[model samples]
Target: MPALNIDFSDEELAELRETAKARGVTLKSLVREAVTEDLAQRRALAAMTAVLRAFTAEHTTAFDDAFPDDAPTGARRRGAA
Candidate 1:
C-alpha cells in the first residue's frame, strides 16, 4: 500500500484527530476505513443501478403498452393528450 498526502482544514483536522483519540484508532486507520466503506457503497450502488436498468429495458415494452400517454419516450406534453 502506498501512502498519500492529503491536506485538511485546521478545524477538520482537529475534529478527525479528536475522533481518532476517542476511538483509540490512528487517524490513518480511520480515514482508510471510511474510504473502504465508501468504495464498497459505490460499487454496490453501481451494481444495483445496472440491475434496475436491465430490468427496465427488459420490460419497457410492457410499460409502454400499459401507459402509452405516459410512456418514457416523452409522449406527454403540456395541456395536450
Candidate 2:
C-alpha cells in the first residue's frame, strides 16, 4: 500500500490526536474511517438523486395525479382510522 501525507494546523492536529486517544484509535485509523464513511455517504446520495430524477421524469403524470396540488390535508384524508 502507498502512504499519503496530509497537512494540518497544529491546533487541528492536536485536536485530532486528543480525540483519537480518547477513542483508543490511532489518528490514521480515525481519519481513514471518517474519510471512508464520508465517501460512502456521498456515493449513496448521488445514486438516490439520479434515481429520483429518472422516476420523476418517467412517472410525472401518475405522481401528480396521486398527490395533486389541491389535495385534501393529510389528517382529513386519513379520516378516523
Candidate 3:
C-alpha cells in the first residue's frame, strides 16, 4: 500500500498517540479506521438526502403542510393523537 504523509502539531500528535494507545491500536490504524467510518457516514447521508429530495418532489402536494408538526414522524400533530 502507498504511504500517506501527514503533518500535525506536537499537541495534536500527543493527543493522537494517547487515543491510539487507549484504543489498543497503532496511530496509522486509528486514522485509517476514522477515515473509513467518516467516509461511510458521508455516503449514507448523501444517499438519504437524495432519496428525501426525490420523495419531496414526487409528492409535493401530499407533503405540503402535511407535516405541520416539524418533529419526527412518530410524534403526533397539533390536533391529532
lDDT (C-alpha, whole model) for all candidates: 0.84, 0.83, 0.79
Score residue 52 of candidate 3 by CA lDDT. Answer: 91
lDDT of 2 by residue, 1-81 (tens): 988899999999999999999999999999999999999999999999999978866765565578887444555443322
* Per-prediction TM-score to the true structure, in the order listed: 0.80, 0.74, 0.75
Model 1: per-residue Cα lDDT over 1-81, one tens digit each? 788899999999999999999999999999889899999999999999999978977777788788877775553322123
By lDDT rank, best first, the candidates go 1, 2, 3
lDDT of 2 at 54: 83
In model 2, which regions exceed 4 Å deviation? 64-81
Off by over 4 Å in 1: 73-81
Best by TM-score: 1
- Predicted model with the maximum lDDT: 1
Candidates 1 and 3 compared: the better one by lDDT is 1
* Candidate 1 displacement at residue 80 in angstroms: 23
Flag clash pairs in model 3.
Answer: none
